[model samples]
Target: MSAPHFYLHNLGVPLLLAVVLFCAFDLTQLDVLISNQFYDPLTHTFVLEHDRLFEKLTHKLPRILPDTTGELAVIGMLLSFAWTLLPKGRFSAWLERVRVAPALRWLTAHRRDFIFLVVSFAITTGMVHYFKSHTSVWCPVETTLYGGIHEKREWFENFSLLHEAGEGRCWPGGHASSGFTLLALYFVARRYRWRHARALFIAVMTLGMIYGSTRVPQGWHFVSHTFWSGIIVWLSMLGTALAFYGRERLSQPALDAPRHAPETAAPGLSEGLSVSGR
Candidate 1:
C-alpha cells in the first residue's frame, strides 16, 4: 500500500474511533451515568472504592508491569550498543557462540524499536500528567456526587480559565495511560512482522480498555478520562514511530531478515555477531 493509505488504515481509523468515543462520553452524560452504576448514593462511595484485592491487581500491577517492561527495554538497548564497542578478538569470537549471542543479535537488529518504546512511554506519561495537573476536572470521588465538597462540572467547563484547578488531578487518567502505553508493543511487533502481531494488537487494546475500566469502579476517573488517555497515548506512539522510521520505511514490506543485520559501524563490527535468523 502507499504511505498515505498505510497511515489511513493503521493510524487514521483508530484515531477517528477514539475521537468518536470521546465525543460520545463528553458531549453526553455517559461519564456520570456509567459511574452511577458502581456508585452507592447511600454511602456516597463507589462499590470497589477501597477493595484491596481489586486495587492491588488492577491498579498496582498494571502500573508496575509497564514501568518494569520499559526499564528492561532500556537495559537491552544499552547492552546492544555496548556489544558494538567490544574489540574483536578471541574473547569476542567465543562470546558469539554462547547463548547470549542470539539475544544480543536480536537486540542489535531492533535497536530502534527499543528507542521508540522508551520515547513513546515518556511522551504518553508526560502528556497525561501535564493535562491532569492543568485541568480542573475532578475524579468521581472528589465531586459532590460521591460525597466531596467540589461540585461536579461538565467536560468543557473544566477547561475554562476561570475554573479553579484543584487538587483533583484526574483529567486524562494516569493509570489508564500506563495500559495504553503498551500499544507501543503492538506497533513495534507489526513493524518487525512478528508472527503474533495481530494477536498482540488485540491483546494490547483489550488490556488498555480493561485497565481504564478498573479506575471507573474505584471512582478515580470518569470513562471519558480513560478514552482521552487512549487517544493521547495512541497518537504519541504513532508520531514517535513516524519520526523514527519515516513513511517510506514503514510502508515497505516486512522482511524476514537475519537477526544480526549489519549495522553501519566499524568495518568488521557486524562480523563479530552471528548472522542467524530467528
Candidate 2:
C-alpha cells in the first residue's frame, strides 16, 4: 500500500477500538440493569444513608422522560453523520495546518522540546490514570435509588444522563481530556489574532462539563469525579505544551540563514561539507 493508505489503515483500528471502548464504558451500568442485576446491591449490601442534593429531584422524577431517549438517539445519529462528513471539510483544513509534521519538525530542531513534551505527557497521563484507577469510588447509584425501572432494561440507563454512558466512564474523564485537548491544541495551532478557535474551545469545554456532570444524579459518579475530570484535562494540556514548546529561542542557524540558501546550508552535513558554513 501507498504511504497515505498505510497511515490510514494503521489509524483505523485504533479509532474503532476507541469508539467501542467508549460505548462499553458508558453503557456499563445500563448493561447491569438489562441483565436483571441492578438490584444486586440492594440484596447483598447494607444501604449507606446520606442526604444527597439529588434526593428531592429523584423523588420528584424517579423516571426520566421517554423523549430524552429519543433526543439522545437523534443526536447520536447526527453526530455520526457529522463525524463522517464534516471531517472532509473544515476539520480537515485545520488538521492539515497543525499536522504532526510541524510538531515533528519542532522536535527535530529542538531535542529539549521533544524530551520535555514526552515526559510531560507521560507524567500527566500517569497521574490521571492512577487517580482514575485507584481513587474515585464507583457506586452505581441507580441500582439502589431506582432499581425497579432500570432492572431488566438496559435501555433505561439511556434515559438518565446521570448514568455513565460511554467507555472510560470510570477513568479520568475522556470528555474532559477532549475538551482541554481541543483548547490547548487550538491555542497552539492558532496563536495569532482572535479567532473561532477560542469559541470552539469554550463550546466544547461547556459540553464536557455538562456531559460529565450529568452522570452524577443517576448515581453514576460523585461531583468530585466531574470536577477532577476538568482539572486533569486542563493540567495535562498545560503540562504537554510547556514540555514540548517551552523553549523560547529558535535554532539560530535556521533563523539567521537566508531563506533561499542552498540545500547544503539547511543544517545536515554531507561527507566533508558543513551545513552551517557550506
- Number of the top lDDT candidate: 1
Clashing pairs in 1: none
The local lDDT score (0 to 100) that residue 160 gets in candidate 1 is 41
Alpha-carbon runs more than 4 Å astray in model 1: 97-102, 160-166, 252-278
Question: Which portions of model 2 show Cα errors greater than 4 Å?
Answer: 1-126, 140-175, 190-194, 247-278
TM-score of 1: 0.83
User: How does candidate 2 score on lDDT?
Assistant: 0.40
TM-score of every model? 0.83, 0.36
**Local accuracy of candidate 1 as per-residue lDDT tens digits, 173-251:** 7787888888888776655555566677778778888888898989998988877887778888888877766666556
